[model samples]
Target: MVVRDAKPDEQTVTSLAAAAGTAPSMFNAQPWRFRYLRDAATFQLRAALDRTLPHTDPHGRALHLGCGAALFNLRVAAAHAGWEPVVTLLPDPYDPRLLATVRLAPADAPDQELARLHPTLTRRHSSRVPFRDELVPEPVRARLRAAAEREGGQLHFPSIWHVRAILELVRDAEGRDRATPARAEERERWTRTPEEARTATDGVVEQVLGPYGGYHSIPVRDLAGRHSAFEQGDPTPFEEEPQLALLGTAEDRPADWLRAGQAMERVLLLCTEYGLSTGLTTQVLEWSELRWPVRDPESGMGQVQMVIRLGYGPPVPGSPRRPVGQILEID
Candidate 1:
């Protein structure tokens, strides 16, 4: 649908922000704000610090990535609306709050790719359960990698040994968090019981909780009670065989994180289109101690930005998203 008539208006900003909300955050934090100048038809976005994950993402790297993902969505929506989005990343060094500025440029119709991927935004939810034994074909892998590259990141599927090392890193991180006192407090604060009052506009929820009592390769971020009925069956062989893809960038920066976020969303949306379920795990990368070594020396792949698991499985139920009106303000 067209977001603007003769020129950019409130509708353009509203539609773009709603579309952008589909981009994933580290914890689905959806931390961002958009300001539209009607006369200039310029859309400006900034990171919403209140949604920042201070405990896990102190550097604001993930926050920027989340915002960047939203920015990418804005571009796509603009294209779908027959406009090319002109974006300036981190446009003003003095005003770091200005993450990006996008002005719509006139364009023809949106292509089939945009049309196909558009619907997946609302349909795409994180799947935390172990995927069925459906092997992802190399062609599918190549397409996912292409999706990442389109938004300026690289997707790498690890070799067997590399996958083993990555799994070990994840296990070590999970074990460390399970023991730390701060981890307990953080989890308690962010994870709501099925009946608990919801917090702010962010975080994983009980519905996205992985099955309990298992060593799954792509474990869900535990949000449910230890004994909740939502938990999956006993840890089966599928636990060791989850599909994994490593997302990376040549250089790491705020802009790079933003690119990675967009790439991430693209990959996830493409997965949804392909009838593949998907989830993300950044636990190991969340700890700086564990992230650096993820770069492979032999292949020259840079440090990993996101670790995603994908396969055919049931889709997770929809989670909460603040109303479009709530996420937008017009002046």
Candidate 2:
């Protein structure tokens, strides 16, 4: 068996880090850090606790999900660059914040499946605008389900009744947020002002918030709280049946959350490659009491990691990312 060299070049590391940095996170918080071990040829993903959304993501499950997505991107980037990535989730139990370690080694054959997704990494952004009522073709839906399954998770398109329950739970969570000043304050920390949005490297910007969903029926999360500058658009009814999917796993541990995150990104990238716009709502799942009913009662899906909306719609602008240098530490 052949082993790869212990060190990768600076340019290679920088490129991979940049690609990994593109993965989506809660409220665009981008709560992750990468450290490349030159001697070991491994890239470590660590949680940036300072960036955590304490009130919204109290248990850090969302943060783990975001980091897991970043880890998958690193794998794709390495594959595209003609290397094989061997990833280990939660590599250090002693340090819970260390989410993953990916060893990039020279490969006899690059991972074509992963390399194929590299191009779509930057193209996939959360679209908060309304999606057309058109149905996502059955074949396309099958492909997305396969994408999640490939990463060891299940993606279920909930039945209409389940969808209604999920939506109502979201409404309840939103109502709770309205009553909880701390939750709103936590959200504001990651939401950029118009001026900040123009230059900030992180957080959800005002422009990308889309016009206020004039109707509460829309599934899009209102990032622009009461203080937003954008005026509400005309009150239009959202589609009676929006294309929604719940990404889940058999368990709800940190390792499971990490796997769920990778699955979520794989599904998102596949959707983007097929020209689908996506939005996410984890509001319901954020609350333990509301999370259980979101699951399909018959499917045996234990935990729902994310609530995703997919359809044909105008693309939303990409959020800013911290510089690669700032996110990557060489050791």
Candidate 3:
């Protein structure tokens, strides 16, 4: 591969990082770092351990998926910036921590399709609010499923019974984790107070937490109410039934997690592109007991990595991101 010094405009760099910022994470915890090599027109992704949500993501599978989503964003940005992103996932297996090293290769040109997704990068957020009861047509879901498949994953739209089953798993997992002293301590450390300046890196804050309500179908682990120190939004009953889909992979491995993350982002981006809102729940997948059993009996997938809820609703308030300076290092 060709390697040489390259320079992009200020707007390009800012926009590129902005795209990466849109990547979804466990509880909106964007725990990933980006290193751009200006000379080589490449972006290197690494898992930022300090930002990790250990209480929720113990094995780093979710961590890798979050980084993978950011990596996918960088690729889309590269393509939109008129270059082909030649990615080497886990380029140095001996240095297993290196999530990906992406080199941008010259391409014919970028088209509208590539440039189109750039806006959605920042617009995409995990919407937890109840969706309008309106159903997402089969054709729209088919398009989304195809989008996931393009990135080596499949999206399974769950039926009513399946949705209820997965919902119970989420509730069980949340209750089990929340009851722990160690997990509660971690939650306190990351959750912020209103007096504090909005942090670029941390857990879900008041603004990002959508309309508050008792845990219902997509059981939200009560982050604020449990603390007893904070007040929550007015209770809105879980009246709307959301369109739920299972984001699954055929294999269960570190590399597969990375691919699943990319697929998750692609699906989310497509949703944004289609003017649909989405909320992501991995509580069931995070708990080992619920993961394998939650997989659709017919899909024959090895694991369910993420449960995505999508429909029409208010957009989730954008969460803060660590400044590029804080997340990057120069070699």
Q: What TM-score do all the candidates reach, one by one?
A: 0.89, 0.95, 0.90
lDDT of every model, 2 decimals: 0.75, 0.87, 0.76
lDDT of 3 by residue, 215-328 (tens): 554555566544222354346676455568999888888899999999999889989999898888877777777787778797767688888888888766876676666666
- Candidate 3, pairs of clashing residues: none
Q: After best superposition, candidate 1 residue 304: deviation in angstroms?
A: 1.1
**Candidate 2 at 330: error in angstroms?**
1.0
Best first by TM-score, ranked:
2, 3, 1
Give the alpha carbon lDDT tens digit for every residue of 113-185 in model 1. Answer: 6556777778888877767877899999999999998888999887767777777788777766666667656
Q: What's the true lDDT of residue 329 in model 3?
A: 55
* Candidates arranged by lDDT, highest first: 2, 3, 1
Top candidate by lDDT: 2
Which residue window of length 10 is worst by lDDT in model 3?
225-234
Estimate candidate 1's RMSD in Å.
3.2
Segments in model 3 whose C-alpha atoms lie over 4 Å from true places = 1-11, 197-201, 225-234
For candidate 2, the per-residue lDDT at 193 reads 84
After best superposition, candidate 3 residue 77: deviation in angstroms? 1.4
